[model samples]
Target: MKKEFSGRVHFVGIGGIGMSALAQHLVHCGYAVSGSDRQVNEQTEKLQKIGVKVHYGHSEQNVKGACLVVRTSAVTPDNCEVAFAQKNNIPVLLREQLLGEIFDAFKQRIAVCGTHGKTTVTAMIHHVLERCGVSHTAFIGGEYNKSNYFFGENIVVAEACEYNRSFLNLHPTICLCLNVEYDHPDCYKNFADVQKAFSALFSQSEKVILPSELQKMCDKAVLFGKNGSVQAKNVHVGRGTTFSLYSDGVFACKCRLKVCGRHNVHNALAVFAVAKLLQLPLLQVSQALAIFCGVDRRWTLHPECKFNVVCDYAHHPTEIAEAVQTALSMCKGRVFCVFQPHTYSRTKAFWQQFVTCFDGAQEVIYLPIFAAREKPQKGVSSFRLAQLARQTGLNAKYFSTFGKTAQHLSKTVKANDTILLIGAGDVNNLTKFL
Candidate 1:
């Protein structure tokens, strides 16, 4: 397909995973790409290596001579580059708007959307499609193995995040909604608001893949779950989940995965449904899923030390509860959780749920909230969360710094104990020290 946009494209906050993936795809599609980020990171460096001019700091000068400026949701209206683009009459697009334009170029575009597991499910679908020799492109949410964006032909598989109703911007041929819960308190008022946004996205999709649990949400959807159109039966959960997939009440194939958790089984089920819908060989799809190691931070285990460390990008209450439960299920020893709340709004919004999410952990270490795109709220803090957890009969402790947290863990964590670093923030940085 011909590239949609011509001339130079500048991305504001290009260091973000989603923004960088779009920039990478645009560069691959033959657009002259230049971007500026607040700080240089691996993503920015990768962009520079791939010939995208990456400026270290945001400035009006960064967007000079650019035909279009793409700004991430985190980028504010007063951001220098965004303001300059508007003032100078350069076309400005939101991150999702550009993604929607890119989606238009593909005939078999699959968008995986959910409050959780979007990254894993999108990456899984991409892997299966690639293994089946289906030419495809994917814009993954997390850095899976090495690259987040894979350039190919025909099909495009991408993670559709629901935050700020961004996924609604995409009109995919195939859409998968793993599950939904109330999240992104800043953008969504409640669960009903979240469901309304997803309902809009589902309505626009040509074919929707959803869980049987959410069958009531969409009437004409290809559902996957215990009682869905595509079902996983005889499931066995261990170091990873192994199950048999049945398509339309008929036995299809048995599959195994290296990625742990029952949640992952549902994620793989969505991928299987996509494969079946696309008419890919079931055996090949199962093979690809079995060998799939997982995205970068989704139950990523480091086994070099006495106590193994598992890192995950699970920040929401449901995700946190699942991560802790999954770690408990796989580990033979005690499961310790080092959790860093992602944002102040989320922490404040889900405070009660967050307190109960750490039920399965043997000991919980609470790190300060990351506060990515929001300023800290007056009464919302990790210390308060820890206090709540302690009140609920949890062995919880709060540490102000990662170094002190690591020190405490080193002293307390015994051999064979599994430390699960859980969050979407820099809590993963503590893994290196451990």
Candidate 2:
């Protein structure tokens, strides 16, 4: 894949954030990019506006005459485009494989991998490098105001996903692991299996960065904390929690973020760890933190109405709890939660955990589970979660509809109430409608 090579490349699942970013990258590099998704949305519209051909539904014609095809794990072998590409001898590559091929051009490839916060952390490192006018390329999961794309290939930051061991495809110079936990039960059978994938990811890096808590899943990885080698200290959890970065042996300067949560401090620290690895000045990393407005929909503030409408992608119980507590701390009033549980298997597996995660909220509104890849389970529904919520002594209500729930939230929440729309799926979009 030369910089001048512009081949007939088509993406099978093109509208997703990751796939669309890849297509956009190819277009920037002069490749003729075409893609097919099951549905049309903003990302497809953005691609079309940028001169990339995109179709609403997948078809064999979409893959025909293409020199190469890019597919995702969600794209099954039976997908018409994938099957057609395979049958016609067209080279088909997965998203991760394509990333590995693209980053081969960079002198220093930095990968951020973790069960959580990889997107924020990767964007953070990219931000610091970009702000200093260091030419770098980045492929993160979210569009954080934190950074932009590369200029002269000084650094290339990529979010290493752990799904199906996808991160393994990329041999990174620097890797991160943010508390690996049991997830993707459909992909991995149990907790040990998830840890094994993470352990393998940790072992491959030239030098790894991890929080002190997950040191058990790893050893000898670069340690970071409020007082670790590459980290922030004196993190006063005032109104919104302020902190400063520390490099090899010097405390750079104090910095504050518009974003909330101790997790974000950890997120920023991961970036600081990589910056130190590259010998970037600690002051540059601290300045980037102040400029970060936060990733889209990751606690994007909505201070328009009486109550602030915070949107986040906290589908997992642990993520939800963290987001809720963060929101609660910021709100002088009460924290109202409008949560849509994601995936049927997740809802069923962690049914009891969801009930208790709302402890930080003043009230809880449960929406139907967003069955991403799983068929809906008969018994495992948001209704069951609402039942459990009641048993936990929280003011809970189950709404099978997002519209009704949003309306309810608008009417019920008092002035200065903080409500977070938490989920991985379309639930966050409701905040926009509000």
Candidate 3:
């Protein structure tokens, strides 16, 4: 093992969900950890509770005592802390590289990858395995209610993000490519460029599982959406989606979800296929999924609100559609869809696609792009998205703030209507008010 930077590690962007989880894991593993982010967030506060010194912003002082300084993909040499690390000759590693090292320690590391539904699938898999008495650790992208079981263990399960080629560093024992799609136009040049990275990872894996749609993308992968391995046939969605798993033949099947969505059924099946491949009992997997409450800020409810309200971390075209359609399918009345585009580049690049994703909403509301790591492009705004949706024959509108969006929804949404606030961004915070 490389022992040059074993004493202390400082994180450059610790407020992010992935960054915070990694920080926690390192602290739990007996590493001296500290970090810096743009602002103080709940995640940073949590890290502080665990005795991690979190600096409010990046600076040379933050990395003072660090033998190693880790930076997120968004961090560049221009970042004060990162530059300081270089000037001081501190061993610097990308976030993925640090995760790769930790993941390498485990024998059964499972990585779930795709353009969308990765979070749900990761949570489903984690839930099933935990219920089946498997001692495993998970680094999910979102917050999950399985608090007692959501933790680190002998087996490391994590959501492998494709942004800036982060997931490529992971060494997975059972790597799951959920489904492939074009995204991250900011980082990757185009769809082919993104696919190239996935192809390389799947090519190197011992057992690669993927949706059948990606077969042409990676020849060696074990396809799942339709053909080679696990297939969910006769899919039905109501109360929850239930479908039979067919490999050589069909198996008697049913699934129940507190969450409603067609995509989630597919997610559950992905979990089933993986667990069964690992020799986990199908019955145990089903029980776990049925009992699993959906992840936090992912279709969560507000306490005082009589109308149905859900908070989801969905921003991509595919993700937005799933959230809206799921809310519509489960509700008795109209569905109000509120969206916050995640980044300027993504909103600009996938503009047309986002317009068509909200197929089932009775009304649509948009918030300014979250701008995860990019400055705003002048022409890219939620109003543009609203206009795009309007062209698609949907009732669309835009708001600059969460308070305004909530106010509009309060007046517009009826008693029986279900409101879905969707985005990977801070749009979910709107739920605190209404």
lDDT, candidates in the order shown: 0.88, 0.79, 0.80
Instruction: Please provide, for model 1 over 1-434, each residue's C-alpha lDDT reduced to its tens digit, 9 standing for 90 to 100.
Output: 33355689999999999899999988887889999987889999999999999898887888889999999888898998899999999999999888888886788889999888999998898888888888889999888769899999889998888988888878889999999999999999899999999999999999998998898888889888878778888999987688988988999988898988888888888888888889988888999998998999888887764568999999998998989888888888899899899999999998988888988788998999999989979989999899998988999999999889888989988877899999999887886788
Give the lDDT of residue 188 in candidate 1: 94
Best-fitting candidate, scored by TM-score: 1
Task: Write candidate 2's Cα lDDT for 1-434 as tens digits.
Answer: 32334478999889888888788888877789999998898778888988999988877887777889999887888888899888998888999888878765667878888777877777777778878778877887876652233334556788888777888877777776666877776778899898898888778777788877776766778888744677677886645668866766577778787667888887877777777788877776677777877787787777664557888888778898898888777778889888888898888878888888887688899888898767887888888889878987989999877678877887888877888888888887676557
Residues 229-301 of candidate 3 have per-residue lDDT tens digits of: 6667777787666666665456645656666678776777678778867889776677788787787877777
TM-score, structure 1 vs. true: 0.97
Clashing pairs in 2: 136-150
Best by lDDT: 1
Every candidate's CA RMSD:
1.4, 2.3, 2.2
What TM-scores do the predictions have? Answer: 0.97, 0.93, 0.93
